[model samples]
Target: MSVVNPLVRAEALEARAYQLRIAEEAIKRNTLVVLPTALGKTVIAALVAAHFLYNYRDLKVLVMAPTRPLVLQHRDTFLRLLKLRPDDVQVLTGKYDPEYRLQAWQGKSRIYFATPQVVNNDHSLGMSLKDFSLLIFDECHRARKNYAYTRVAQAYISEAPYPMILGLTASPGADREKIEEISKALYIEHIEARTEEDEDVSPYVNPVAVEWKLVRLPESHRAVERTIRRMLDDRLQRLSAMGVIRKNPKYIFRSDLLEAGEALRVRLEQTPSPEERGPLFAALVLQSSALTLYHALELLESQGPQTLKLFLERIKSSGKAGHRAIVSELVFNGVYRVLESSDLEDHPKVEALEKLVLEQLSSNPSSRIIVFTQYRDTSAYLAARLSKLGVTVVRFVGQADRGQDLGLTQDQQSLLLDRFRSGDIKVLVATSIGEEGLDIPSVDLVVFYEPVPSEIRYIQRKGRTGRRSFGRVVILATEGTLDVNYLVASRRMAERMKKMVKELNSELHPIIRLGPAPEKKPIPADWIARAELPPSSPETAATTFEAELESVEKERRAKFNRELRETARRVLNSVLTAGKNGLPFEELCTELEEEGRNPVAIRSAVERLRAEGQLMKKEGRLFPAGVEAEIPGARRHVFEVLRVQLGEAILRVDDSFNAILLSADYNGPRELLRRGNRFSAISEIYENDKARHVRIYAVEELSD
Candidate 1:
C-alpha cells in the first residue's frame, strides 16, 4: 500500500487509480467530479487543495458543504491529510458572529471550511472572493434555482480574479435536465464521472448483495387503507363539486393535490375581491384535508399502522380540519382499533425487516447497520421496535424541527455519529437527513425501510454500505403499493444520470466560452443624434466623478473595517461606562458597528480583550472585570413562554423555557410559511437548565 501523503496514507485511505485520474483532471480544469460514495471523493478534494497550496502560496482555497456537520467532516479530512499550520485552516459556521466570518473571508486562513449559507451571507455582506483562487463545492448537484450554491458560483465568477472550481458529488443528478442545470449553474467546464461498475473502481469496490424483501399488506391493514382512501375521495369530491379541482376525484393523487393547492394559492394572490376568495378558502380546506388523508392511506399501506398513528397525531396537532374528517372516519370504521394494536401483523414489512435483521446478526455477531425510512415517525417507531427486539438503536434526523419531530442539532448529530462509529449504537433508524453527505463508519449492512423514487436519494442510500468490505443491502417493498414503482424508478433514473454525464463529458467546453454575454450592438446613428445630450465641461465632469467616487468609498467602508482594533477599544470603553450591570451583548456589538467595525472585525477585537481577561461575561451582558454591583447570574432569569414579533432587527430571546426552544420551529396557520425569516432574525435560543448555560447547537425559530 503506497502512502498518498505524509499525513494521509493507504491505511487511512487507499488512493485508487480512478480517483488520481479525476484529481489530475480537476487541478487543470474547472471540473465536476462524480464518483460514487466511499470512493475517496474527499481524498480527491484534499489532493486538489494541496495542489493549489503548493502551486500558489499566496492564494487561499475555500471548501463549502451544505450543512455544518458535512463542513466539519470535510475540514477534519483536510486537517488529517495535509500538515498545515493551525491557523492556516478554519471552519466557519453560523454560530460565529457575522463580523468574525467576514474577516475570515477577507483573508485569514489559507484553507477555509464553511457551509454554503455562511459563504453566501459573507459574500452578500461585501466580503471579497478575489483572494480565493480555488473553490471546492461539495454536493454540487444542489447548485440550481435560488440555492446558496448557485449564488456563490455567480459571485465567484464576478469577484474572483483567478477563480477555479472543483464541484464534487456522489451523483450529479437524476435526469439530463437537472444535470445540465447544475452544469450551467456552476459553469462546469469538464465532467469526469465514475461509478462502482467502472473497471478501475470495480477492483476497489466490494460486491454488495442487494435483495428485495417483499411483503403483502395484511387484510386488516388493507381495510384501514381502503377506509382512509374512501375518506380522501370524499374530500376531493367536495373540491371537485366546487369547481376548484378539475381532476376526477376517484383518481386524484398526492402530487395532483399539491399542484391544485399551489394553483389556487396563486389565483388567490391575483384576485382583488374578498367575495371571490370565499369559495377559494373553502377549497383550500378540502385540499389540505384530502392531502392529509391520502398521506395517511400511503402510510397505512406502505409504512405500517404505527407510523399512520404517529402521522395522525401530527395532523391533529396541526389543528387544521383537513385531517379532522379523516381521523373521525378512522374511528368510525374500526381502523383506529387496528392502529392501537402493537402487533406487527398490520405491517408485514416490519416483521420481514425484523427477520432480516436477526438473520444478519446471527450470521455475523459484530455488525454495524443502518435502516433508511421515509418519515421521522417511521424512524421513531422502528427505533422503539428494534430496541425491544434487543437491538441497540437510535433515530437520526435533520435540523428542521417539525411538530413533534425534534430535529437533531449539528453537534448532537456529530456526537451520535461518533457513538455509532464506536459501536455504542448497533443500528440507526434514519430519515432523509442521514441520506446527505454526513459520514458514518462503513457498515456491514444497510436496510431500506421503504423504496424512494428520487434517484439522488436512492444513490445516497445505497452508497452507505460496500465502503469497507463486501456489504449486504435489503430493501423492503409492499407488493402492490408505490414502493414497487419507486424501486423501478430509482434504478431507471440512476442509469440515465450516469449515461448522460458520460455522453456530455465528450463535448466538454471551457466556461469562458459560456460567459460575458454578448454586448448590445452600437446604438443606431439616427437614434444617437435624437437622444444624446451635450458634452459636459471639464470642471463639471470632475465634480460628478468625485461625487460618484465618494459614494462608492462610503458604501465600501460600511461593509468592512480597517480600524477594527480601534473600534474594539471604543466599544470596551462604552460598555465600562454602563458599569457592573453591564451592556447587553447586542449593545456591545452595535457600539462597535457604530465605530465602523463590521461583525467579523469586532468579534476579533472582543476575543483579544477576552483573552487578556479585560472583558467579563455576566447575565447575558459584557462588562470589564473588577467592577461594582452584583454580577447578574445568566441563569437567574427564565420564562416558560415567549411571544416574538416579526421584525428586521435581530431579537435574542433567552429564557429558561426548554419546551419553547424545542418547539420553536413548530408551525401554525399559513402565517409561518409566508412570513419567511432568516436565521439571524431570532437569536440566542436556550434550553432550560439549572446549569444556566446557553444552547449553541439549537437553531432558533419562532414556532408560536
Candidate 2:
C-alpha cells in the first residue's frame, strides 16, 4: 500500500516498512540515515519532509546536496512525489544570482533544493535558517572538516528554533572518528542504518555479481618501473641520510612521504634562522621529488605507459628545481628513451575493459555500462580506444580544466547524461566524479578500471549498478601492484565500516519519549487561512501578490547592496594597509571572517575592489593600486585554471599561490582558460600567500 497523505501524490510512493520506520525515527531527532545505495534514501528523506510540511505548516524544508546535479535530482523527486504547487518549490545553485537566491529564500518557497555551497554562501550573506524546520544533508559523510556542509549544518542548528537535521549517505566510512565527526557536525542524535543483509532490506535488494580480473604488467613496463624505482630509491636514501625521514625505503608509502613533507613544512615555518634552513630546504625538495617519483611509479603500474609518459613530459617541461632535478636524473637513466621506444600504447586493463564491454553489449544490446577509472587520463584513453573499436562511449569527468583536458560544464554534463539514458551513448568512461550520487538506475554493468582505497568510493561505485535489477561488476586489478592492494584494502574497509556502523547503532541510545510515538497528523484547517482580502476578485489577488513579491524583492536587493558595498570598503582598506607586501586572499578572508563577514560578501568585495582599480594582484598577493613594486624573477610552476573570463584566467598553483593569466600574455589556444586545465607557466612576481599578476612566458598543456 502507498502512503496516505494529502501532501504526497496518491500511489506515487510505495509505503515500504523499513522506510517508514526509519522516517519515524528520523522525525523525532536529528538523525543520520546510513542506508546502502539504491535503497531509496531519497524516499526516506521525502517521507520525512512530507511529514514536517504537513505537521508544521508555517515551517520550511531545506535539502542540500554536494553537486548541482544531485540538487536537481532531489528537486525532481520531491516535485514528483509531493502535491506542492510548482511555484512553491525552488532550486538554488552557484549558477543563480545572489539577488535571486535571496529573493527565493525570502519568497513563498517552502521546499528548497540547493547545493550546500550556495546555501552556505547565502546563509553567510544574511539568509536566515530560523524558519527551516528540517535541513536534509545528502552525502553527509562530507560534513567533516571545513566543508560547506559542516558550516551550513552548524548554522542551522544554532539558528533554527526547533531544528531537526537528517544526514543521508550510502556509507559514512570505516573510521569511527570520521563517523563521529560527521555526526557531531550535523548534530545527529540518532542513526537509521540498513544493509542489504537486513531482513527488511533484502526483499528489495538486487544481487550484484562481482568479479575480479587480475592482469600482470608486461616485461617492457616492468623495465620502466624498475628505472623509476631506482630513481625513487636514490631520493629516499638521501632523505634518510639527512635524518628527514625515518622509514626504511622498502617500507615507505606515499602517505608516509606526504606526512613527512607536512611535518617538514611545519618545522620550516617554525625555524627562522637561515643557517639551519638550508639543509631543511634541500630535504623538502628531495621529499617532493621522491613523492613525484612515487606517483610516476603508480601511473606506470596502475595506469599505462602513455599516462606515465604524459606525467614525465610535464615534469621535464617544469621549471621547479625539484622537477628539473627529477628530469635530469630521468635523462641520465635513459627512462625517457625507454618510454618512447615502448610498443604498448595502454595498460592491460584497457584490453580487459574492451573485452568486458563488448561481451556485455553482445548479450544485452540495449545495456548501459559505466566504466570507472581513477584518472582522467585513463578515462580519455579508454574512451578513445573504445570508440576506435566501434563502441559508443563518452568521457565523464569533473568540471576542472587540466592543461588541454577540458571538463564538461554542468549543462554539457546533464545533456550527456540524458543522451546516455536515452541509449544514444552505450558506455560512459567516468573518473571519480561519477562515483557519487549519480542516478543511473538502468546501468547494466559497472567496470572499475582501478580499485579505490576508500570504502565510501568503493560502495558508491558498486552501488552504481545493481540498482534496479541484478547487475554485474567487474573490477580490473593489476597483479602485484597498488591495484591489488587497494582492492583488498577497500573490501576490508567496507567490512569494517559495516561493523562500526552496527556497533554505533547498538551503542546509541534512543530518544526517550514522554508521550506515544508521533503519528502523521493532518495540517490544521486554521493553518490554511490566508490574508483576508474583503472578497477580492482572483485577478485582483494575483496582482496584489505580484506587487507584494516586487516590494520584497526590492527590499532584499537594497539590503544586499548595502552589505556588499560595506564589505567592499573594508576589503579595499585591508588591501591598502598591506601596501607593497600585500595580503594573501585567503588570509584576508580569514581576517574578514573573524569579524563575522560571510564568504560571499568578502568575495564580492574583492571583485568590486579589483574592478574599481582600488586593489591589484601581484604574485598571488593583493596590493593597493599605484604600488610600483618591481616584478620578481619568473619561475616555473604548474597552475590549475580555476575560472576563465574574456581576456584573463584565474590560475592556482596551490592554496597559497594564485595567478592571473591575461589573453595577451598567453599565446596558447583560447581553450586554455577552460576550467580545471593545468599548464606549466613562468611567473615574474612572487609574494607570500598573495595573488600574482603573471605573464605566461612559456605554456605547455599537460596531457590528460
Candidate 3:
C-alpha cells in the first residue's frame, strides 16, 4: 500500500512491516493482540491507525488510554508515528475549559487521545462522536462493564460511520469471565496471545526463573500464638453464624484479634511499664497476624502461596525496638521458632517460592528487583530490614490518606516510578497497583511479597521482567494462609488464557486453515414447527406472576407517597412556627406524630428531608426549607417570591439565619414563601428569577 502519512515512512519501522501486516489483517477482523509488556503493543496500534488514516482521509481517529498521563504518552507516540503535523493530534481532558475543548475538537486534530471519563463527560455536553472512524482502547482489558471505557466505546460504535475499534493491554484481567466481558464490551472478534510456547513469538520473548521462599516462624511467642488462635476461632464462629464463611479453620480470622490489639494499645497508653509491655508486645504480634492474614489471602489469590514467611518476618520486626535481641527473642522465647520449625516446610507453595528467590538471589546479586506484597506496612518493614542489610530498597506505596484504606494518588505513584526508572532505586516494594500498567523500568528480578488471589496480578507480576533481558520471579509463601488457594487459581487462569489464545488462533490465524466457514445449523424442522404453538399453561401462569409483581410495586409506591406528603407538611409547619430557629430532635419527633406521620416512618422521613436539603440540621435540631417551591405564572397569587430565571446560582447556607442576600442583579423584592404552603412569604420579596440560563458572573445587589 502506498503510504500517505509521513511518519509511516520511517526507516526504523520497516522491520516491523510483517507485524504491521498481521495487525492490519487482524484489525479487519476486529482482533485482540495480547503482546507482552514492552513488546510494542503501541507499535501495532500506530500501524493500524496509519492504515485506517491512509484509507479514510476524511474521518477522525480516536485513541483512549485509561489514565491522563497514558493518554498524553499515546498522543506523543502517535504524533511521531503518523508523520502528521503537530496540529493534527491532540490530547483532550476535562481539565481544560470546555469551551476551548469544544473548539479544539472542531479543529484539524484527526487523532484524539483521551481518558474515557473526559470523553464521556464531553459527550454529555454535546460533543459528537459521529465523524470518528477508528477508535483504539489502550489497556483494553479494562473495557468491562460500568467503566467509562465501555461507555465511550459504546458511544463511538453507535455514532461513528464505519466504526472500527482496536484495544491494547499488558494484561487483560484475572480470568475467562473478565476476558470474555472485555471482548463482549469491545465487540472483539479475534484474540492473539503470544507466549514462550508460541512459535512466532518465542524468538522475541524470554523465559524468567521463579523461586519460592518460606521462612519458619520461631517458637518463643507461645502466648502470642495462643492469643491469635483463640481470636481466629471466635471470629470464624461469627463468620459461620453470618453465613459469610464455612472454613475448616485456620490460625487467623477472629474478632478478638482487633479487640486484643485495641486493649493492648490502651494498656500501653496507660502504663509504659515493662510488665504491661510483655502482653502489649504479644498483642502487636496477633495484630500483625490479623493484617498478615488479610494480605496473605490476597497474595495467595495472585501468587498462590497461603503462608507468607517474609511477611510475618517483616511484621514481627515492627514490634522490635532493638537488633539481634529482636531476632533472638523471637527465636528463643516466641512462637515464631515453633512455626518455622513446623512440618509445614514441605508445603508446596513455600517450597516453590523459596527455590525461586534463593536460586535468583544467589546467582544474580546485582539484579534490580521488585517484591510485590499486599500490605503496605509489611512491604515497608521488608524494605527497611532489607536496606539495613545493605540491599538498596525503596517502598513504592499507593496514595492513601492518613487513616484511609486505599491506594495513593497517581502523582505520588509517578514520582516513585520515575526514581525506579533512573536507577536511583534498586528494589521496588509495592502493592497490587504495581501489577497493572504502572511502568517500572527493566528489572532483573521480581519477587512476590506473597501470592495474590488474582491471576491477572500473577501474570502481570511475572510479565514485569524478562522483557528486554533475562529475569527471575520469586514468590514468597507462608505455609498456612490462603496462599495455596491463590496458587491454584493462578494456574487455572494461566491454563484458561493459554487455551483461549489457542482457540482464538485456531479460529483466526491464516495457517490454521479455514475450511468453508462453518454452516449455521438449521433449526430442527420439528422445533420450528413447535415454535408456532402457544405457550403452555405453566409458562402463561409464570408470565402473569411478573405482572402481579408490578402491580404490587405500584401499590407500595402509592402508599409511600401518601406517607411522605403528610411528613413533608408537618416538617414545613414546624419550620414556620420555629421561624428560622428550627426544632430539636425531641420536639420534631413529637410534632411529626401529631402531624399524622407514622411514628415508624417519622425518623426515615426526617432523614430523607435532610438528605434532599428540604430540611437542614444544625446543633442537633431540624429546620425545614419551608416547602418545595412551585413555578409561578404572570397571574400567580404569590408575587413576592424571588424567582431566579436567568442564570445558575447557589444560595449560600451558613450556621445562622442571616439577612437575605444576593450577588446578582435584582429587579424587585419578591416572596421567600408562598400562600397555601407551610410557611407564608412576606408582603414583598426579591424576584430576580429571570437569571437562570447562563452562570452569572457576579451578584450586583442584595435585596430583602
lDDT tens digits by residue: candidate 2, 1-704: 22335666555687778998998888888899998888999989998898888876777899999888888778767755665654466778988787557656876777899999999898888889988888999999999999999999878867776788899999999999998888878877888888899999999989999999999998768777888899899888888777777878778788888989999999999999999888888889999999999999999888898888888998888888899988988888888888888465567888888899999999999999999988888788889999998989999999999999999888788888889999999999999888888888789999998889999999999999998899999998899999899999999999899888867765555433234333445665443333222257745754665555457546655776787777876876666556556789989899998998766677777776666655667677887553542335656556788888777888887445777777776643354568987655444544434656767544322423
Q: What are the lDDT scores of the predictions, listed in order?
A: 0.72, 0.80, 0.57
* Model 2 alpha-carbon drift over 4 Å, by segment: 1-4, 506-704
Which ranges of candidate 1 are over 4 A from the true structure?
1-13, 236-251, 331-334, 341-346, 402-405, 506-508, 513-567, 571-704
Give the higher-TM-score candidate: 1 or 2.
2
- Of the two candidates 1 and 3, the one with more favorable TM-score, higher being better, is 1
Estimate the Cα RMSD of every predicted model relative to the unseen true structure.
18.5, 15.2, 19.9
Q: Taking the tens digit of each residue's C-alpha lDDT, what string does model 3 give over 316-421?
A: 6465443233344446654455456643322343344334444555786656677787766556555665676565667766556533335656666667776777
- Predicted structure 2, TM vs. truth: 0.75
lDDT: the better of candidates 1 and 3 = 1
Q: Compared with the true structure, what per-residue lDDT tens digits does model 1 show for residues 154-176?
A: 99988766578999998887778
Q: Rank by lDDT, highest first.
A: 2, 1, 3
lDDT accuracy of residue 474 in candidate 1? 90
TM-score of each predicted structure versus truth: 0.72, 0.75, 0.56
